[model samples]
Target: MALYGITEREKAVTVTHAGVPHPDAECHGVVAQATQNRVLVVFVSALQRVAHPPAFADTDAEVGKH
Candidate 1:
């Protein structure tokens, strides 16, 4: 919770199990509260964009119209 900058957890919980979020944890009990590091960890679910790989989807165009 370093102002949303410093956090890399893999279950070695510490910092008194972090804090500041417990609104009835849900997502797997909020990742089990980060093994007690409370929360602020988002393993995934945040990529509104940036998934390139369709520069033409199997290209075959050269300014045509059937």
Candidate 2:
């Protein structure tokens, strides 16, 4: 269960898209792999950390209800 520095504990990975949890794709006994030439690598930009460009509505005095 060990290869390419993947320990037995890391042999399994929770299903995710761009590192975002995807319960639909999760499966027991599934094995995930990482390769330099494949699309298995995922990079996620934290939503709360992302800086969205300011919009004109940001200046509006009225705040929208949640």
Candidate 3:
């Protein structure tokens, strides 16, 4: 993915269990298929959660603020 600066081809595979995304797998596809800005946005958003802890009591008003 663009976030990783690498190219990868999608492969078909059968899965028996629930498939989960990896923390480091920021982008789903190859870098060539993504824009630098899009990658940066996702990266920044992930970092924001780390830098700022979420409110314990989240409400509809809080969600609307963003």
Candidate 4:
């Protein structure tokens, strides 16, 4: 993913819950994945030009955009 110089802040914004995307939301998908340390507690607004960050560091590998 670093090959793209992709960062989370520019792509995904944090959300509170699994609500329908707002007109202002930019996410493309939502997935629930397991983590190593602990399960994550945040939601991500997916991006097409870049990949989204894991809800928790060291969770699944960063989820990619479609």
Candidate 5:
């Protein structure tokens, strides 16, 4: 996961990557951030859903454990 962009209020962030979309296509992986320089990352299959800010610690903990 990588930092793609930041939100308008600067309270959120966006991370993006290449991933599978739906059952058939590749899509832009978008993750929301609201933390530090690394922020947070999430792979969103649906671009529309990325409009919200994603939790960072939860994502970090989940990925970090793995």
Candidate 6:
């Protein structure tokens, strides 16, 4: 889970991977920081609702343990 800070006034998105400013898309706010576990949980939950991917079922349990 990579953290990004998007500046609407400058229309730029900043990430830890690069020092260069990336042009922002149609977005409202920025994410200053995010935890890998939290992001993965949300991702897997969405996948479960839409695709129900088999691999992710096990991961759900693993994530809960953590």
**Clash count, one per candidate:** 0, 0, 3, 1, 0, 0
Local accuracy of candidate 6 as per-residue lDDT tens digits, 6-65:
344333422322322222221111231233366655664554456633323333335444
Model 5 Cα RMSD, 1 decimal: 14.5
Candidate 1 error regions (>4 Å): 1-25, 37-40, 44-66
Residue 15 lDDT in candidate 1: 25
Q: What tens-digit string does per-residue lDDT give for candidate 2 at 4-62?
A: 33333234432221222222122111232223423332322222124322221243224
* lDDT tens digits by residue: candidate 3, 1-66: 244342231122112212212222334323323555776666666664564322232435454356
Find the candidate with the highest lDDT and give its number: 3
| Superposition TM-score, candidate 5 onto the true structure | 0.14
Q: What is the TM-score of each candidate against the true structure?
A: 0.15, 0.14, 0.24, 0.14, 0.14, 0.25
Error of 6 at 35 (Å): 9.2
Model 4 scores worst on lDDT over the 10 consecutive residues at 29-38
> When superposed on Cα atoms, how far off is each prediction in RMSD?
17.9, 14.1, 11.1, 15.2, 14.5, 15.9
- Model 6 clash pairs are none
Tell me how many residue pairs clash in candidate 3.
3
Model 4 ranges with Cα > 4 A deviation: 1-49, 60-66
lDDT by residue (3-59, candidate 1, tens digit) is 122233323332233321211123333454556643334322121123222222333
lDDT of 4: 0.30
- Supply candidate 2's per-residue lDDT for 2: 32
Every candidate's lDDT:
0.31, 0.28, 0.37, 0.30, 0.30, 0.35
Task: Score candidate 1 by lDDT.
Answer: 0.31
Candidate 6 ranges beyond 4 A from true positions = 1-36, 54-66
